[model samples]
Target: MPNLRDHATLHFIVLIWGFTAILGKLITIPAVELVFYRTLIAAILLGFVLVQRRQPFRLSTGAGLKMLGTGMLISAHWILFFASANVSTVSVCLAGMATATLWTSILDPLINWRRIAPFEVFIGLVIIVGLYVVFRFEFDHAVGLVLALVSAMLAALFTVINGRLIKKHNHTVITFYEMAGACLGCILFFPFYVRYFFPKRGLVLVPDAAIDWVYIGILAMVCTVYAYTVAVKLMTKFSPFAINLTVNLEPVYGILLAFLIFGDAEKMTTGFYIGTLIILLAVLAYPYLNKYFEDTKNAWKDRRAEKRAEKQALEKQNTTNQDPALETIKVNR
Candidate 1:
């Protein structure tokens, strides 16, 4: 467990992450362009850090390519995330993003070729029910909600893949490459985006106001880079499970921050709140439930092993005594 200061630092990190959504909304640009700038800046900053540390930038061909590819998914997730806020209330967007836990629960099993625990399945269904309630009450924001949900799924996928990659590589190296890839993805996407989806003469590459630049810088440096660095450092003190459990508070922090920053624009209906509460409750409970089940499973395995050992020992003793008795009888005869 983390101490009080560690807990505070963890929550502060989460709060910074929550602010990213607010910054996205504050920036005046298309979601695609926003992602491009964010990725570019982050990649540049991370590269400088690596060079300063004298760390090698080179990686195996396959691993290098894999990290880069994962960047496109990251780009898509942020694009959808910002777009969600643009299309609807920040509260609604955060609510949709909250379902990321549900998506991860489902995706992790299939991706890792592991069985999905019964508890995970049950929690997923319950989350779906919460989503349905929100949908029924806030029908007007349906498209935004859908976009946010898809973004959550993408985020989950990226997380699962990144978990594997991190085991064999330095996180900053992987992230630097992924940031470059995200930038590349945006470059490739720009032509098609302006030609069809956005339907403009050219890309909206520049920020109109100075504050927009300020917001974008904070989004990249503070939220993306700083927060990640802190989390990695704290990993030595906190188990990954504990860290992730704390991370589940992201939506709660985001929603609160949205209300504070955006005021009336962020408020939603009573039903929406109820449904969101349900979803959050399930997400927050997941780590504890998973830990309990995992411990129970290990206990059962140990008990069975002990029983088998005792039975084998008893059988060997009975066999030894019977063999001596049979030998004595034969000798007497």
Candidate 2:
């Protein structure tokens, strides 16, 4: 079981992750360039930490390739995530990303080869309803919302993949390779990004302002390196469901922070808030509903077992009563 400290640590990690969007928006560079720098810096930092701790970075070729692919997914997730915020308000971006839990519920069963739980589907439907509400109110930001939703799906995918990888590798080692892979992935995409997306400005490899550098540094070091490393480590103690459930609170923290920092810019219509509340309620209520259903199932099983035992006892008693001669013979013997 996880201790209170473990839960607290996970929440702290989520808090850091929540700040990531604000940092992304603060930086002036395009989302792709920002991801490139973020990943490169994170890779360097994690590499230094590994060298200092004398941790080996060796892995099988197959695993290395897999990590690289996972890194590309992570890169896409970050690009879309930041792009959503750039195109729309932070609240809209976060509201769209908040659908991650629902995606996870759908994806986990398929990925793990488990039967889909009806209760999980019900919760997913509830979240969809909430998202619909947000969509209806914030129709102007539909494109950004769609991008963020896709980003959330990618986030859920990589998370499930990491759930498999962490069992066989150290969290730090995994992060080092993944970050390196993400950096390389970004580098490979640079040409296409420049050609198609920013043809007019060309490639933007550096931060435009000094404060942008500070924000990127915090994003790479504090958010990416520290928070991600700790989150991966905590996965050893916490189930993916529990971790993702807690992460549902990210939007709550982020939106509140955005409201405080960006003021009116982050505020949404009343319908958006209502929609967000519905989604949050479903996310928050999932664990309780799961536990209740599981407990009920277990209790029913226990009662059935007790009934079987009692029936067996009565049947034996009746058998003994019917066979008095045999019982008497045995007793005499």
Candidate 3:
């Protein structure tokens, strides 16, 4: 069970994640510049914390490479996430990301070589239906919604990959590698982004106003570095499913924050709310359903093991009592 600190930290992480969208909206820089700066700051701040605490910064060369690769995916995820918010509303971007659990369900089997349970498929389908409802009627923001879904897919992939890396290394160490990778990815993409997306436009890298600095600080220091590390630590106590489900509430929190910050611009139609409720319902229900299925699977495995043990015991008794002639016949047979 989660303790008070666990609950408090989890909620705080969700709140920080919620503010991510708001910060993205408020920053004056473009998505590329914003993500580039965010990762750069987060990497530096987190590196300082790790060094101050005297944590190990070592990983195997192969593991370090994998972390860097995952970090690149994380960079892509954030870029898409912020771009979604820029083109559409925070609500749409967050709502689409809420489907990450569904994506994980589908991807886990392929990555881990496990049978994909029917229950997981069923739950995933239900979430898909909710997303369909949201996008069908709210088609004005379909492109942004799609981009957010792509972001969610990338998020799920790297998140699962990180779970493996965490078993062998500290989260801070892994995070440092990933942060470096993200910075490199943004640097590599900037030239292409400028050529294609902002052709003929002069470089606009720095924040224009002091207010932009505030948003950037919140995004980098609070949301990215601090919140991410805290959540990584909490995974020792809470299940990933539980953590992720709570993360779904970030959309709810973000939408509310959007309303408070942007007021009329954040308001939506009745259909949007209905779709949002359906998505939230699916997000909340998934953890319970997953736990139940896991329990059932373990129970069945225990029963099978018990039956096998009993059979082995009976066979041993029969063998010990065997007559010489019968033993010889059995051997010949």
Candidate 4:
């Protein structure tokens, strides 16, 4: 098990991840352009790390291609993520993203040929009800919430794909290609972006503000690359269950940070907070529920086994207690 320092470090890394949305809001570039640069810079830095470590820069062609394809999903997820924040309050964006784990829970069983846990389905419904309450109160931020929900879905899918790919490929190499792929996706998207989304100025190819560069650099190097590397390293000392439980706190951290940083701008309706709280509670409750059911099931099995042993023992006692004359008669026959 991880000691106090390891756990603290894990939380710190998660805190950094939570700050990502804030960074997105701080950067002045459009979401599409922002993702382009974030991916590009992260890719370059990851590449440099690989070189410094003297890691082989090779993979089976098919795996490399798969990573690249998954990278496109990563790009889309981030574009939508930042766009959601840019368009509406961070509260709405994070509230939607709060369901990503539920999405993963659902997707994992379906993809891996396992039964969907009943608890997952119940938690999903609870989350939906929470979302409904939020949408009812914060109706104006509906578009942003919807965008964030879609982003969460994509995030879930990318995670599931990565789960498999990581078993075969080095995580850094996978990330490097995915980042490159994400950048390539942005480049490919520029034409359509110019045609439909940003007809006026096309792509905002460069950051106009110097502060934007600083934020982008922090986003790429610190948040994207460094946080991921550290998290992966921490995995050696922590269980997946522990890691996931802690990660569920990301939305909480992000929302609170947003409120502290943005003050009144980040405030939402009371109902919104209630809804978000409900969703969070359900998400956090899952592991405990799973353990509870598993333990109960084991208990029942143990009780049944004891009862079975007692019954067999009683039957043996009855057989051994047979009269001696009857036993002798049977033996003579």
Model 2 lDDT at residue 250: 92
Worst-scoring 10-residue span by lDDT in model 3: 201-210
TM for every model, in the order presented, reads 0.95, 0.86, 0.91, 0.88
- Residue 256's lDDT within candidate 3 is 89
lDDT of 2 by residue, 242-318 (tens): 98679779999999888988999888899999998998899888877877888898999999999999999999999
lDDT of 2: 0.90
Q: If the candidates were sorted by their TM-score against the true structure, best first, what order would they fall in?
A: 1, 3, 4, 2
- Which candidate should be chosen as best, given TM-score against the real structure? 1
TM-score winner, 3 or 4:
3
Decoy 4 TM-score against native = 0.88
Candidate 3 local distance difference test against the native: 0.87
Q: Which stretches of candidate 2 lie over 4 Å from their true place?
A: 1-10, 232-245, 295-333
lDDT by residue for model 1 (1-333), tens: 569999899989999988888888899987899999999999999999999999998998999899999999999999999999999988888999999989999899999999999999989998999999999999999999999999999999999999899889999999999999999999999888888986755788888888898888898999998998899888989987889898989999999999998898888999999999999999989999999999999999999999999999999999998998999999999
Residue pairs with clashing backbones, model 3: none
What is the TM-score (0 to 1) of candidate 2? Answer: 0.86
1-333 in candidate 3: lDDT tens per residue? 789988988988998899898889888788878888888998899899999999989878898899889989999999999999999998888888888888888888888888988878887877878887888778999998999999999999997898788788888888888998998899999888888888897457877888898888888999988888788779879987888678878888988899899998878777777887887887788888888889998999999999999999999988888777797999999
